[model samples]
Target: AQSVTQPDIHITVSEGASLELRCNYSYGATPYLFWYVQSPGQGLQLLLKYFSGDTLVQGIKGFEAEFKRSQSSFNLRKPSVHWSDAAEYFCAVGYLSYNTDKLIFGTGTRLQVFP
Candidate 1:
């Protein structure tokens, strides 16, 4: 079994400051990592995902993440934060088994951007 951990439950940053959300996973093999963002009362939106190939992958909404095998981390980073970017961010680990796909999600980190 694998799990995702988002150590930070809440984070506050200046509107124009840089942002980084930590995400760690526990898995024996290389598993898929995903970052999703959800606005208030909205559905989850895919930020980015890492399956294989490049360790660093780009995503929508000016977000990107680098899969660090050594650290077992796939952290999301944005050079600058905007007030509209404030939302609940979730880190998930997913894989296919027995022709079925499963995803394990973290508790999520609520982002607060101050102007």
Candidate 2:
């Protein structure tokens, strides 16, 4: 079965510091990869995605992710962190089952930004 894993349960970073959120997926073949952010009491918002082409994909809010097939990882990164960036980050992969596509989300990584 396809699965997504976010090893980091929680992370604390000082405001203005660099941030990196790790994500790994297990699938027979490379699937559609994605990164999403969820604020408290808010729905998840798409950050970035890797469908094809370039391994490094740019996303909203100063975020970028690199898709490494060798590592089976798509790690999200930001040069600088902000207080508002604090949120639950999720790595997901789209899987096709019986011609229906569904997203399999990771456990989620909670990020806390300190001023």
Candidate 3:
């Protein structure tokens, strides 16, 4: 089974400060990892994804993540935080079976930005 873990349940940061959200995944083989953000009462939007390519992948909204195979981790990072970035972020691992891909998401990390 594929699973994702977001150790931080919530994080608070000041605006203009750096932010890092942690994500770890477990899978038998090379897993498809993704980061998504959801604003209040909104649907999830894909931030980035990792399938097969370079370890580092760039994403929208000034976000990026590094896929560390050895550590089984995919951590999201932003050099500076913004008030608009406050949202619930989720990390997911995808598995394919019977020609269907299912995403297993982590609990999620809620980001709060302060002035």
Q: Which ten residues in a row have the lowest lDDT in candidate 2?
A: 93-102
The lowest-lDDT stretch of 10 consecutive residues in candidate 1 is: 24-33
Clashing pairs in 3: none
Ranking by lDDT: 3, 1, 2
Q: Could you tell me the TM-score of candidate 2? A: 0.96
Runs off by more than 4 Å, candidate 1: none
RMSD of 1: 0.7
lDDT to native, each model: 0.96, 0.96, 0.96
TM-score of each: 0.98, 0.96, 0.97
What digit string (tens of lDDT, one per residue) describes model 1 on residues 1-114?
Answer: 799999999999999899999999998888899999999999999999999999999999899999999999999999999999999999999998889988999999999999
Q: RMSD of model 2, in Å? A: 0.8
Which runs of model 3 end up more than 4 angstroms from their true locations? Answer: none
Question: Per-residue alpha-carbon lDDT of model 3 for 6-115, expressed as tens digits?
Answer: 99999999999999999999999998999999999999999999998899999999999999999999999999999999999999999888899899999999999999
